[model samples]
Target: MTTAPLVRRAHDRGIAVLTLDSPHNRNALSAALIADLTDALDAAERDEAVRAVLLTHTGSTFCAGADLKADGIGKGPGLLVGLIRRIATLAKPVVAKADGHARAGGLGLLAACDIAVASDAATFAFTESRLGLAPSVISLPVLDRVDPRAAGRYFLTGERFDTAEAVRIGLVTAWDEALDGILAGLRAASPQGLAESKAVATRSLREALDSGAEELVRQSARLFTSAEAAEGMRAFVERRDPSWAL
Candidate 1:
């Protein structure tokens, strides 16, 4: 595990900080990372001392979206759904702490968190449309958090925005500040209090995930399997423009 990129560290303040340490791929949500994150989240939820969960990353980019070049990319949509769901529905409050750029599905992960804070310099984009895919499954949690009008523009344009814009659009809770204070507040609360209050706070989002996830999964599978998406993803890996980028 010494060489593994995913780092799990439990703070004495009862916060489980899960770092997406694989900066080689900009911590792309590969199958392995997804599995590791899901397992870690489950463990945190069950840990008696864990009052909350903090999801963060290393390197300049929080996540570069999916590992477009991964071996099992075909199975990614379902796995992504599960990973996002796990974070959203975890018993404890989940907070996102980012000091880097996040794009595509990475934004989905941010939206699923109960609270998300990012550095003032961080940026974000919903690049799914450019990849010949839609933020279908992620839209479940994302739209729930984001302003409908702002989500419409970003989802369609796939344009990048700054952290201040992210906060304005409701994509993130705030610009990065004293996260220790936030964690301390959680630690001060009874675990059951935090859990139950979070449940109340996220009830609608959880329902949206549960009730709407199936069709979105099918939509994601269909889009990801399409020839258009293949070219887009290939172009992305090639660091070139897709054919449709005229």
Candidate 2:
């Protein structure tokens, strides 16, 4: 059987919309997907006509998180960490159009974008703790976007939260039925203006991510190799709850 490319790119009116298309795995952040996303982002950045970038997905679930069962499980977290950093530092304005659920690492991807517009039906969660892992690498972006108090609650509990709650906590900018207007507005800006503006806006976030990425990636790698996380991942693939689940 032939599988489709994980990430798809489309350009319209100076906007480069990158869609995560691996719905078979809920657009999971596998190595292949991560590489494709990185390449797409680079292509958009180099395109003189591309004024803005839209990060979205094709499936009902935006992203289910890392491909834990993939052959390169240990490297998934680090690659995701790099991807989020790239999105945050991208010269063009990047918007996340989340039309579906985004969980665990998916939330990190959403948070790293310059703006996130989610649908009313969209849901989000941290979900790492439930797997006996931590949102270590992802925290670089997640912590900056969400309110500290809400971050504390969600980070520890890994509970699924609704779109309204996600907006209130700053996980997303707003819930909108259509994103064409936003994209149009973004397209109106000059490439130089957008680049300068985004550079100034995300300077702190870029610095923070760069400074903490090494440690966070190490923590993530360590957690993924731990006995607890091993058991949790095994249970997940086996279609059962984690051992720590009540």
Model 1: lDDT to the true structure: 0.86
Superposed model 2: Cα runs more than 4 Å off: 1-3
Q: Which run of 10 residues does model 1 get worst, by summed lDDT? A: 1-10
Per-model TM against the reference: 0.94, 0.94
- Please give the lDDT score at residue 244 for candidate 2: 78
Where does candidate 1 clash, by residue pair?
none
lDDT of 2: 0.87
**Candidate 2 structure quality by residue, lDDT tens digits, 94-152:** 99998899999888898899999998779998888888899988888888888999999
Model 2, total clashes: 0
CA lDDT, candidate 2, residue 15: 90
RMSD per candidate (Å) reads 1.7, 1.7
Which tens-of-lDDT digit does each residue in 125-232 have in candidate 1?
Answer: 999999899998789889889999999999999999998899998999877786777887888899779878988988888888789888998998899889999998
